[model samples]
Target: MNILPSYRYQMADHKKSILIFYVVIVGLSLIFGFSTTLIINGNDAAVHGSTSGNEMATVIFLFVVGLCTFKETFLISLQNGVSRKTLFTAKLLTMLSVAVIMAMIDKIFFLLYAAALSITNSQVTASTFYEALYPSSTAGAGPLMLHAESFFFEVLLALAAMAAGYFITIMFYRLSKTGKVIVGAGVPVLFLMAIPWADQYFLNGKITIALVKLILTAVNTPSHMAVTCLLAIVVFNALAFTLMRKAVVKQ
Candidate 1:
């Protein structure tokens, strides 16, 4: 069987869901943008509006979509007798394609927002999500380079999220009912209880400081952050595939 064609067909099945997601996002953006414009127009002094929330929304949407896609695709493909290897390849391709498309859409939306602000003669300033993510260095780069870097980072982040979602799904699928219960309930409870205990007892209330230092280190080293993210993506997907290879389809 030609796996490429089969994969394309399987991805096509998700067009409706993708379209709905896009529509919802666009609709909300319009509502918020217009409302903010109106509010600013009514004010006496010049006000600036920011669309920084768009990046967070995009990340969350991609993550949720990734989780749904992996779970649904795995079940359908398993029922249809698809090999684990083919399924993994298909999922990887689908996630990359989706990441590219979403990144382009985000850029387009930013342009549209900027144009609207200009046309309305609003004092509001708009920036691309990439600018928000890499505020300092992005401002120094040429437009093409800035966009290229943004696209690359978006693809890496999306792939990482997809891999994580797939790995989680596989873990659940491979667990027994009791194990699932333990994972679903016990894990969260442990995190809730253990975090404070560890911070107070083990770290002497310095966990927050350590976390801030780690974040600052990462922010200072973009290349290292990118490499770390890529490594995480590979590890997550590798674990997911390993689990899938040994997983039995649920009856």
Candidate 2:
């Protein structure tokens, strides 16, 4: 089969979920602003505006999509005689396209949300996850540069998240039932229990502090974040392709 069809099919799968996601995010935000205004301003709740980092939700959503989209597609493609490389390539292209589209949509929403917020109640201010993290990094940049940085960060982070999800699905596909159960349980145990216990008792939180510092240093600027995310995306996809080569059609 043509790679274009696979690419389009993958994108099509994401389309409905994305629409519903935006509808819910925007709808909930509207309700929040209106109700908050109504309660505080005593019936003067006309189109009040607020802001938060909605892009985080998009990243998480794309990750879940990645985790869920693989099994059926992989099974169907192998049955239809599509090679693994073509499947991987199509998925890569689809993830990149989705990242770009979602990034654009996210930035557009942020601008519109900001504009709307400016016209409404000034009691609450606007901020973003990036701004909250690196408050001084882009404070002196031009409007175009600021937006470009934000767009790049959105694309890169979302892309990386999607790649990680795909890698996870491929890994799970390759694992046996018992292996799957062990991994599914072990990962949470490692993070939620072992790691915390080690960091707290054995390492005295040094590991946790070091990790926090590493993350902060790596993402101190948009360019830094871009590089970090690109590396992660590359590693995740490479591992995924390796896993896919060994993935078999399960009954």
Model 2 clash pairs are none
lDDT of 1 at 165: 75
Show where candidate 2 strays beyond 4 Å.
38-50
Clash count, one per candidate: 0, 0
lDDT of each: 0.76, 0.83
- Model 2, 109-204: lDDT tens per residue? 778767766687444445665666567886887878777877778888899999999999889989999999999999999999999998898888
Q: Tell me the TM-score of model 2.
A: 0.88
| Candidate 1 lDDT trough over 10 residues, lowest sum | 50-59
Candidate closest to the true structure, highest lDDT: 2
